[model samples]
Target chain A: MSQQLAVGIDIGGTNTVFGIVDRRGNILYDGKMSTKAHGDITSFLNELKERLDVLIDKVGGKDNIRGIGVGAPNGNYYTGTIDYAPNLRWRGIIPLANLLQDYFDVPAVLTNDANAAAIGEMTYGAARGMKDFITITLGTGVGSGIVANGQLIYGHDGFAGELGHCIVIPGGRVHAGTGMRGSLESYASATGVMLTALEFMDSRPEQDSMLRHTPRELVDSKVIFEAAKQGDPLAIEVYEYTGMVLGAALANFVMFSSPEAIVLFGGLTKAGDMIMRPVRHHMEINLLPIFQNKVKLVFSELKESDAAILGASALAWEMKTDQKAETPQP
Target chain B: MSQQLAVGIDIGGTNTVFGIVDRRGNILYDGKMSTKAHGDITSFLNELKERLDVLIDKVGGKDNIRGIGVGAPNGNYYTGTIDYAPNLRWRGIIPLANLLQDYFDVPAVLTNDANAAAIGEMTYGAARGMKDFITITLGTGVGSGIVANGQLIYGHDGFAGELGHCIVIPGGRVHAGTGMRGSLESYASATGVMLTALEFMDSRPEQDSMLRHTPRELVDSKVIFEAAKQGDPLAIEVYEYTGMVLGAALANFVMFSSPEAIVLFGGLTKAGDMIMRPVRHHMEINLLPIFQNKVKLVFSELKESDAAILGASALAWEMKTDQKAETPQP
Candidate 1:
């Protein structure tokens, strides 16, 4: 018998990364496609199916492929639909999982990208042995996937883990898209860091900083992190403020679920101790005494490039287990 | 065969209520003892056992009793202990459950009062058929119990559902006991409502209301509720502000767990529509569009007097089921 494998696909706004992964979480083969190039869902699936077929053949044909798991924006696990993902061209609910299953003649599952990251962490990263923990992905927008009692919390609507949108500062910073003020996403995301940097620079007229030299449009989380590393006071302040907000929000998350650990993933974590110190400080300061020193805040151990694919593939393996449970053998 | 029964105990600061409950949740007989009357745990237990034996004899006796369940402040379910309950006379961790088991020679379990209420709601009240819901007890202090996927969330440490401590208004009201500022318990509890009314009165010296006539020390949640009934502007404003804070916290809770419903119990909820209207309105206003108007904020249907006993009895039933699972007969 051939070694069983699963296909993992991570659908992003700009690009989609897909890979054939073994049971041990190794990506045997990987591929990418331009997400924006295909205007419709059908075209996107056609391109994906065509590319995946070649990869499947290389890995000993379709029989060896156990299933396909997809991680997409606003993905709903229960319905297997992607609903109104702002970054994606798709306007409404798209049955991407069903489409993939039909095209490949294999079972397919889908979940939000953040949830996929959480599953990835559980399967092979920071949350490997933990039954209760939250995975926070601080990227273009903040996203979260909560795991409790060794199971991902899908909730009643299968959209339980939207921690980013939880308002950290009521009536404070207005979110660009949601228009909701003081949301964690509005203050802690990569975009949020840039916005905070811009605001800080604008407030201080006499302070000389590397960020001030760059054009407003060119300034991003990367530039701000670089400026902080070079000891720019304004850049340092930006991270401090961002971490404070993120920490307070994390404390709230801790109080809610009482997770054993909270794993931080994505771009913001790249700042290392610069961002982590304040987050740790404020989180402890805000937490109740019972929870104060109990929760471990750690970064994702999964390789960033492989995390999404691994997470999606973990979902595929999960489906195989579910199928086995449902069908008993004599 | 005699119908199996369980002894349910609700241990409060001033008084302790105990009853023999059947499988269908009916309290066959009930009695109370003054908790503060006894200075030591042994004395308290002796008195409680002496009184309870008479009640047990009225029924079918000890053979008919399946188990015992106790609900108290700061109760730890895993260890069956009550740790440093500020309101109670007990100084340190009291192994109340183990003590009961030793005394009665039957199985006994323990949990926090709020968790008991949640179990009660699930077993005999509003949350009877609901798999995902939160029970918020707004008494002297705020407390909560969360149920997800048809089980109470005890988290990694068996103390997961501590929603009262979650900060709603950062740096807002300071909790008298926890010393934590801006906690949900500080703003949404009955005591919080009294404090809010008192603060409002102090701020607006020019405003005339029925509360002005009542001595400052005399004002309580019941007094404020009576004043709100008469449509006093100051009293009414107090409920509105309390509701606003509660609503915002409820919105955050909804975002965190996405429970199907949030059941409100205890004294503060008795303000009825005066509190519920603003809570529902603000909860919707603060929630993201997807979660807006989806969560049901309902008052618990269990009789306030019977809820604690019923909840504890449910724990006894749960223990019985667990025992059966552990020891399967051939």
Candidate 2:
């Protein structure tokens, strides 16, 4: 038989990436489309289909493709819909999985991006062989996927793991759009880092720093990280503050779930020990005696470019395995 | 086939209650012994065995018993040991389950009291047929058991659920013995309620109230609850503050796991809407829009007297089923 493969699709606001991946997590063929270029859901689906068809053909054919899996914003595993994802231009819930399955004539599954990352970590990355762990994605906003008892927790509404929104500071930083204050997302996300940098600049107007040279609009997480690397005191303080908030939140999460490890994923982890050192310290200091020195804090092992695709594809493999378990021999 | 029964034991600092329970969760016979009177682990075990033997005999015989399950302070499910339970006179790890099994010639399991309560809630209380829910015990201290995906979450270390120690207020309400600050237990437990009442009194000495009639030493959770019921403003404010702190913590817990409901058990729930109204309000206010209306906050339906016995018994039933699954049938 031809090598079995699954199609992995990572849907983002800017671009949509699809790849043909082998069972071992190798992306054999890859394709991409501008998500914004498609004015409507129909056009987006058509473009995705055309790209996937070409990739499938290159990978031996659609017959060799076992199924398709998607990771999208606000994706629901139970209903297979993207429910009111704010970043997406789509007006309402989109039955993206069913649409993909209809086009490809194969089983399809979908979950939110963080859940996909968690599955990726569990199946082929840092969390391999671990029964309980949390994969925290620190990106444009904070998101989390919780794994307990070797199963990804999709609570009653398939939206169980939204650890980002857990209030960290209790009326501290307020998100402009969501009105959520003191959330871990408000302090730990890349946006949070940028906001912290801006607050520092405002608080200490007399202090000379490299961040002041850059325009307010241009100063982002990258600029702050670069400044901190060059030993800029203000930027260094931003990381310290960010990591302090993050570490405290992580300590609470450790107490809540007692995961073997909390794997950090996405952009903010790029700060490495600059952020991790303080996080580790605060987490240790804040933990209960029984929980202290037990939970591991580590970074995700998945390659950044491949992680999203791999995570999405892992869902397809899981679905294929579940189907086999349910079927009976003649 | 003869009816299957199991022994359920709740080991507290003052008393150790053991019961013979049928498969359907009925307590056929019950007995209790003064735990403090035993003075040592060996004597405690001897006394426990003697009492349990009498109860087991009344329930039919040893042949009718499937196994034993014990719930106690600091009980470790994986090791079947009570590790460093400060309230107990035992100085070190006590292999309670193994000791019981050796004397009874049957399998034995042990877990923390809160975990047992969670299993009981799942099996025979408000959480029946529900796959995801949290049982929060608000007695002298706050305790929790988190159930996800139809399985009790025993994390990598077999201590997954400890929501009580999750810090709600940073550098606040330090526990005298543990030195743990800002923990949910420090604010939401019966002790926390008493402390809050004391703080209110200290801060507002000029305010006329019913609480003043009771001496400062006499103030406790029960006294405060009764005073609140009588419409004392200061006492009423104490419950509001306690509920606010608790509700905020509960909101965070809801965000962490996104359980279908949070079942409150033990003394504080006795305050009813006086406490529940503020808790519900604060919990709703603090939650994200997506999480706000979806999760339920309900009081546990299990009877206080039977809950521990039922919970421990549920563990035995679970073990019996697990054993059946492992054994090969003839």
Candidate 3:
């Protein structure tokens, strides 16, 4: 099975996605299953193993299966485990890859989904040739993958590149996960976008904005984008405000990584220019003269739905390549 | 004069300072001269060169010198030039290292002052053992120096670490230099801090704050710090607001470099915990749970006056060490 094929798996709080991917970023086979209903991680692994076995059979009897790569919410590359992940109600260190490898008798590796996305972008998405860049997902929550010097920074404990949490405003707003006020996520996530629109509605109750017509809980970004597309003022401001916060956060990242570009990916970002224009405007207005025209903001080419899986798969390939390169192969 | 001691020159907008430094980060001798009150930069270089010869002879004489490291406002390491610098009234690139090297009969290297500070931190200051960290200075303007994967990122045009220009707010308020709006500098730099104080003052004209005693044009951070120390609510809020902005920017940086720490230097940082506490609180509030309790936001150990000289000397020492390390032995 050496150098034959690798399984790329991206595990989330709600769903588990695994794909048989080759060295060239091609998906040979794939499957989806729910990540254990409770904290029963072992059960989740067992289910994954069963599904992988089926995929192996579908791909001609598993003769070419070499290893597996897993991208999880809180996977730690250095420790070869996942720490307390709030989403899955998991605590302590879970030797996820090792446990799964025991069942399949093959090499297994893992990394955080953010780092995986970074590797995916480097290998196949918007930042393909750039040495430095950041990829952000404005999904249920915001996710950031930072790439510097053409390599993902795992930091001292493989817990680096947490871009979504940085506060854009201190004492200015509130976020669900963090107790602090004015985090970038507070202003720019899917929920954050709605909050912004909701706050705008609250501020101008007398104004005849379309958001006033929408219920608070029923209010979502898709509806907001639809309104913006149809010339809704408040809807447009939400995207602009999101872009402003995102742009500010990104400018700070640009300072640190000096990335040539930043790729935006996520469900909220499907609005495209409605989002990018404000982010760019703020970035331009905020950047110093030297970085004025040097960096660019781009959209990820990978499908928003499949990007996580592709990114996770890329991480596995990258880890294997690094190990092979450094192991003094005979 | 072939082996005369290497010169470490620190050039600024107002004055030019040069010193003969050895490979050990020690300044053997030094002197300064006015950098021409009016037009042209050649006069400054010629005067600097003449003074350097005098200092060099008084120390170890000409043969002891080997090279020169020029730290300037817009010096470029790769090109060995100083491009246009707005503060210096210079508007074109000059082969500064070449011009000095030929004159001193020694190799001359060049880099921006902030970069020199970063290298200085790497060689002789707080960041000596670290490979990833960011250094921010709150001075006339916000400036940053970045070290990634143990090497400084000069970026595409040696402009990679420009943190001052990234917009923190887009079209919300405050103008920034980089054609953007609401940059970190708009609310964090010394000037930025004062701007906030001024705005705060406008809404509280009758307050008996110590800040009211100081004239507007003559106002500086020292006055604000003194007022805060004297229990001035306005001054205290100014400091808090400044920290809020800085914390947000640092959080932004956390997402990108994921540095172990961010070191703050310069005058305004004299506020100490008044600034650090809020920034830490804000940063914590904004960071993702995975990145929590990991990143350190601390102060720089280097003094403002001695920092430039020490950093410049350290920069030379670094170049000397690397060049010596790379040279073929007999």
Candidate 4:
């Protein structure tokens, strides 16, 4: 019998990446396309289908394929819809999973990218065998997935884990996407880091920093990381402030769920100890005595380049397992 | 066979209430004793057993009893221990459930008072047939119990749902117990309300208020409630401020679990719309657009006088159901 495969699709603002993965976490075949180029959902679906057909044929068509799993912004697992993703061009709710399932002639599942990352971590990364842990994706914006008793907390609605939006510095900084002040995403994400660097440089006129010389458009998380690594005091302080905010938020999460560990992922993690050090410090300091020094804070073990596709793929595998449990054996 | 009954015990700082209850929420027999009068655990246990035996006899004794359930401060559900409860005379972890089981020759289950309250609400109160909800107990101190997907979030360490300790204002107010600053409990409890009233009076020395005429010792939640009802501006502002802080914290929690409802219980709920109006207003304002009006924030339906005992009793029923699942019938 041919080996069963699942298709994983990761929809980002700029690009979309899809991969055909086997049950064992191997990416057998992969492709990419421009998300912004397809102005409408129909055009995006058609382009995705046309590109995926060649890969599906190579892997013995739809019969050998188990299902498709999609990781998208503001994705809803229960309804399998993308409900008004701020970063995406799609307005209102799009029945993306239904569209995918119909086009592929197979079942498809969908959840927010962070949730997908959490499942990926549980299946094949740092959170392996840890029943209660949280996966945080610190990218352009912060996203999170909370797991308790080995099941993702989907809550009453499908949008349970929105840690980024949890008000940390109540009435502090306004987010461009949410318009809410003092959210974790305002200071913890890559964009937040850049904003902090600019704010610090502006606030302290006499502070000598490499960031001051760099063009505003050119400065990003990577540049800040490099500057911090080179011992720029201003760049280092930016991470210290960011980590402090992130850590305090994490401490609140710890008290809420008492997870065994909190796994960090995405672009902001590249700062390594620069962010991790203060995050560890502030998180422990803010925690109640019982929860202090207990939760393991670590980075994702999955290769960042492939983590998205793998995370999305893990959902398909889970869906297949659920289906088997529902259907009685002959 | 005689109808099955369970024993429920609620251990408070001042008093310990115990009752025999049937599955249908009927209080068959009940009694109370001074929790502090018995200075030690052994003495407390002996007095408790002696008082409970008479109630058991009235209900046909041992054979008819299903099990025992207990609710107390610092209670650990998994270990059946009460670890270092500040209010109680007990200094360290007390194996209350194991002791009860040995003395009564029946199973005994234990959880924190708030968790027990949540179970009670689900079993026989306003949260009946609801799968997702949170119960916030606003007594001397704030306490919370979180239920998601029909199960309490025990977390990895059986210490989940400590929403009271979740920081609302970073470095804002100091908690007498945990010494943590800006925790929800520090601002949302009955004690918090009293503290707010005192602070308001102190800050506005010339402001005409009835509270100024009343002695400091006479000030409490009930007094504040009465003052607010009588249209005292200072007292009314106290509720508004407390509710604003609480409402913001509730919004953070709503973002975490997206619970269908948030049930308020204990002393503070007596203030009614005085507190509820600001809480509803601030909670809605802080929430992201998707989560704004979806959650139903209501008062718990359980009668406060019998709630403690009823909540503990509900745990016994749940324990029996769990045991039945584990051990198959002939």
Model number with the top TM-score: 2
Output the number of the lDDT-best candidate: 4
Query: Model 3: per-residue lDDT, tens digit, B218-301?
Result: 677778888888778999989887887677667667666678778788877889888888888867655666667788777777
lDDT-wise, the better of 1 and 4 is 4
lDDT tens digits by residue: candidate 2, A1-330: 353888889999999888988877888988888998876899999888887888888877877878788899999887888899888898798988777778887778889999999999998899998989999999998989999888898887788898998988876889876797888999999999999999999989999899999999999999999999999999999999999999999999988878999999989999898999999999999987888898889999999999989999988877844442113111
Please tell me the TM-score of chain A for candidate 4: 0.94
What alpha-carbon RMSD in Å does predicted model 4 have with respect to the real structure?
3.3
lDDT of 2: 0.87
Model 4 residue B189 lDDT score:
94
| Candidate 1 clashing pairs, residues 3+ apart or interchain | none
Across A272-315, the per-residue lDDT of candidate 4 in tens digits comes to 99999999999999999889989999999999989999999888
Provide the TM-score of chain B versus the true chain B for each model in turn: 0.94, 0.95, 0.90, 0.94
Candidate 4 has what TM-score? 0.95
| lDDT, residue B215, candidate 3 | 91
| Runs with alpha carbons beyond 4 Å of true place in candidate 4 | A1-4, A320-330, B1-3, B320-330
Full-model lDDT for every candidate = 0.87, 0.87, 0.74, 0.89
- Compute the lDDT of residue B57 as modeled in candidate 3: 72
Candidate 1 Cα deviation (angstroms), residue B159: 1.7
| Cα RMSD to the true fold for all candidates | 3.3, 3.1, 5.0, 3.3
Clashing pairs in 4: none
> DockQ (Cα-based) per candidate?
0.70, 0.77, 0.39, 0.77
Per-residue accuracy of model 2 over B218-301 as CA lDDT, tens digit each: 999999999999999998998899889999998988887788989999999999999999999999999878788888889998
Quote the B-chain TM-score, candidate 3. Answer: 0.90
